[model samples]
Target chain A: MAINKLKRHIIIFVMFVTLMPTGTAIADFAVIVNKDNPVVSMGKSDVKNIFLGKKTFWPDGSGIDVYLQRAGKAHRSFVLEILRKSPQQLSMYWKQALFSGTGIPPNQLQDDQSVIKAVADNAGAIGYIAPEHIDTTVKALELK
Target chain B: MKLSRGIFCTFLFVLISLQETPTCLAFQIGNHLSLNGYLSQGYIESSGNNFFGDSLDGSFEINEFALTTNYIANNQLRLGLQLLSRDLGEEGNNEILIDWAVADYHWQDWLGLRLGKVKLPIGLYNQGRDTDFLRPMVFLPQSIYDENKRSLLVAATGGSIYGNFFLGNGGYLDYQAYYGKVDFREDSGQAQGIRYLVSNISRMKNLGSVSDFDSENRYVCGGSLLYSPPLDALRFGVSYFTGKTDFDFRVGGRKGEASGTNKDFIVLSVEYAQPDWKIAFEYSEFTGDRKALGIDIPDGRSQGAYVQLCYHLYDELVLSALYDIFYADKNDHSGSKYADQGQPDYLGWRKDFGLGIRWNITNQLIFKAEHHWVDGASLQLPIFNPQGVEEHWNYFVLKTSFNF
Candidate 1:
């Protein structure tokens, strides 16, 4: 009986070790603007609405222009970890908006550097990238 | 087609909504009756030329206004009704009967059946297209589903059967099927789909007399099957349908444009969600015949698909982007068109890239903005041809939408 109990203990311990999460699971995000813009803050919803086409103009009704890095590892991760949209739901919205004449989608840049460059020059431009990609041209707006 | 849409939207806003008041007030007599209904309203402002050469301007005023309500019967059943209107303007005279009907049914945590005037289960978006709360965008795409109001078939007429099916894999499926006849205004005087293209039922209207026009019927039968697997954060859906659509246009005084069609649609979707961040992608297509003028377009097939990526930064703010494409061709039987017109190719296609940002000021209230660049050609619309690309076109658009 003692031997059987000992075996059970071993199994449970093995399971615990196997189930423990490894590596860095924490996600980091940043709100990017043109390096030269004076605006410096935002809310999560404000960012989401701008991307979803729900808010066409800025808070003050300024013409807002949004840019994105082309389809790639960084772009994909940013969308999943920061944008909060899945590949499928976003696609459906695109077609629905386009065919219905509600709106068109955005122009895709080839990489993170390109996106950073675009957002850095335009006051109305907004986007996000990895914290490492942050440079002198673009400023990161801390979220509330 | 344009005329047919105007008439049907008008019918949806004017005709159907009128009948709802009487059904409610009639029951109000001799009762402490306080009746209320669900309300929904919105409008579409776009800038682009459509299939019919109509230009879309970027504008927004009021699109819909509705009030739907009901009464409780015994513990097992409820009686309900709705009054709806869309596309209201300041000076232009525009109104239609979008929804005005009553329903009676029983329900529980797992199963239910509703009967009366209700939304039709035509496409992924048609059933709930009018309510902005159910979707992120202002309208569902026309390539997959169109939500034009119709006068031929009852919006939520007769009855509908719905149930939940479990796949034993920690996944679930929702199924629904309905049987009813619809009122068409374009030709049958009922709008088939809402996007202003299929809204014109009068284009084929050859039937004579109001009686003949009002006497058309559309026997529609279809169902949707949805599945979400347990092994992955993925969802799948398949829809099948077969029915006889009636348009008011008459051949030999038949009083209806009776055309038979089959529908098959497939969807594959996936979602990877995490705290503070979530992303989703869905691909769907409709493959079947679009009945028109009693002709089953030969080689008539249409398809559409899109991919989107998004990031939620904070409570009401997010960033997103997408790529889209849709195509269709006119199944022409006339070996060829006039020599001057040649074989009259009607093939069409469009591809687009977009980026967007949105802010949700409140849970029920949202403000959104988006930008898009487009390429490709639509079979019946204006297009640009790149130096080496076939009929390549380019254009950009900016848009905004709000719902409460």
Candidate 2:
């Protein structure tokens, strides 16, 4: 009888863990720009173009400086959700562009903090980080 | 022994490079200067015919190395250059060459210009063939990226204009157009292949003392168009090229030229992708007219196609399978008619089925192995397979690469 009761408890525990909501587990990431930039909101297509080097300059005539976090879950999420590309596909596209002399990839940083710092220091810089890390030096753009 | 020594040196260089703990793959001297490079070494062996080296006995004379630099002058301008060195059996022979040098200007998302020696925007894989770390397989499908005629299709010295247009509803069109001339050298494998084809045609026509056949490029111009819809991961493209060449033939110590030889080709490609699996297919056709050495050959049409599938086994490992076919003459799938004219029938077409596996040792290091079972000899270079080719053969390849 005791063994039967223990098995029932184990099954309930496994079900509870498996049925939990994923939103609470995964952290929300946000697109960020320098505090001085006038960009208010951006569509997903606009973000894709900017990150892929298709849009070089902002509306105000300053160059758009792009930054990226080195390969990680956040990087993968940003590529899939915003850029609409798989990580491997993104890497392959960059390699082709680099070798063919068509364009260059964005500057890559090691972590979110580094990306935030770089974007904060540059006037027209843009990058992405976890939502909780947003501070006064950078403005988080709303995804449309 | 000489080949083994070369392999040793290549491995030693890779080992030494790995020991250095660099801050980044690219060197940043200032705000605008950045440098990148890559190196790869490969070994091939075959059961009957030779490819890229004395592969029948196994050799290591296949390698590729390149260095690239980029300068960002301003928001609208960028300049870049790449120098390449490569060897493939008796082909490239470790020759240092300029791969590409271009000045690119982007006025907007819809318009851009590239001027200088630029890579030919052919099928999807031509521009990245030498970059081993970019793909999961050691060699691309030979039917589309034909190794025998690389110089004829790889790059051009001239100018190009490209752009992307949004079609609304998540649809887009990407287009590229180029005008230029390709460079051909006497020592190139394409030249040797052309020489062999000319000699065979002359002999068949009973022309006397035909020798010293040389080829020169006149001009080439083409464009590629690709469409992508809002669909998950799908793309379709069509590319076309038309060019003219002049060949000089020496018959009985007399020089004669065949001018205005027209060459035209088209390729259609389709690809579907997901995070872990991808499928692709491409079909191409080449048509041209040949006349020289007091003999006239009718307009010849050839076709090649392949279907490839790749699956990621692990996060860093991939497995692939491909079926490739090439027909020297689309109308004559069987070489019986050509054989009746007193030559080998196996030259009519070739069919190959291949399997490959690749492992990413690190983001910067890669290892790959592949095997192929082939039937027919239509694409084999007669110079390399002088001992004659077997109708059916198999080949194996192993390669390693490191890039920064």
Candidate 3:
């Protein structure tokens, strides 16, 4: 009877391990803005506008500084989950804006840590990072 | 002497640029100045007929180089300029010239202004056509973005106003409205095509032929509107432009004029994007009236379209396929009228099946190869091919580019 009990426990543990590994690969991103930014909550549309250079200033009339990761896992997730654009699509969009002399792409940093630091240093800066990396230097915006 | 000078200047420029840090990131020199540039060369070979400089014997006459600069004068204003040198077959001749120069002012997202030479925002890809690193294929679809009419459609000298309206929920409407004038050179491929038509008209009517001909365009005006819904990856657009052109021809030592041929066009576009794939389609109709010439001319209504699909084979490699169609006259899809005139039926239209592969060798270098199986002779320039025309032909192209 004890041997049967041990076998059942082992089977349950194996099932748990197998199921956990199959969880969705899509990741959620935390949109981070400078702590001093007056805006409290942001919708996905607003985020898109800010990054695409449609919105140039914050509510207080201060110039908004946008930073982004060059291209990687975090960049992909942010574009997919927040901006709803693939990397290729976003590249095309930025190319049009650049060549047309209408707008400039956001400054690209090396990694999430650099993005966080950039936002923390500037009063009007905004960016995104993985959720676990969010800290006190920046405030994770509440998605509407 | 001129070729050697050009080669020397290009070498010096590249040498200087290489000494600086090479990165795709915007290169800033001061508080306001930023720079970007690229260089590309291509080789072409065809199974029949001549294209882009003696392709019947295989040609290496296609190349492009450009340097662009942008200056932020203040938070409200910016200045930009680009100098470009390009050659294709016997055209361009590798002459460096100002491609565009503009001063822009931003008042708000709802309103902004641009003055000077501004690139026309035509169709989906015209404004960004010069950038080699941005496209999946070395050449864009010829149906809508024909190589012969490139300069005529690229940019104009004047002013424009642009804006965007936010509709909420990731939806928005964007637009640009402009008025300007475009220039056409006498030696351009467009001029060759026009000459062919005029000579044919003279032969059929038994009237004097046109020679030493040229054209001038004026009072161009147009606008484009794009709408994006809340959907993840779909956008739609419609654009139209119209202008007046005067064609001057010399006959028997006397100058004759075809005044005010009103030219107009409309294009509709749709694109869908995914993580690893994209699909796009565009349809265009162009019309012109040459009744001012006081002679019978083929109805000047043309239509063209293309459907394209691209798939990412890997992070650095992509494969694309396209099916494009062009009709010289919308009313004569079968070319029967042209056939009645003793010309091949295929001369009235072009249908092309194309496949291409592009590999980004590194951040700064790229290689591309493409092939086309074409079923018509519509785009062929008779002046370049004294040997005659072919109803069916095939061509292959290889290109490499470096960007900094």
Best by TM-score: 2
Superposed by TM-score, candidate 3 places the C-alpha of residue A36 at a distance from the truth, in angstroms, of 1.7
lDDT of candidate 1?
0.48
Per-residue alpha-carbon lDDT of model 1 for B232-312, expressed as tens digits?
A: 334455655444554344434444443434345444445554433545455554444545444454435556666555576
Error of 1 at A123 (Å): 59
Ten-residue stretch with the least lDDT total in model 3 chain B: B1-10
Arrange candidates, best lDDT first. 2, 3, 1
For each candidate, give the TM-score of chain B. 0.64, 0.90, 0.92
Instruction: For residues B234-258, write the lDDT of model 2, one tens digit per residue.
Output: 8898888878777787865778666
TM-score of every candidate: 0.52, 0.90, 0.89
Instruction: For each candidate in the order shown, give its overall lDDT on alpha carbons.
Output: 0.48, 0.79, 0.78
Tens-digit lDDT track of model 3 for B315-368? 578899999999988999998887998878887899989999988786667899
Query: In terms of docking quality, how is candidate 3 classified?
Result: acceptable
Q: What is the lDDT of residue B236 in candidate 3?
A: 93
Rank list by TM-score: 2, 3, 1
Give the better candidate number (1 or 3) by TM-score. Answer: 3
Clashing pairs in 3: B52-B89, B53-B89
lDDT of 1 by residue, A73-136 (tens): 6566556544565533443344343222123344446667887888877787887777787888
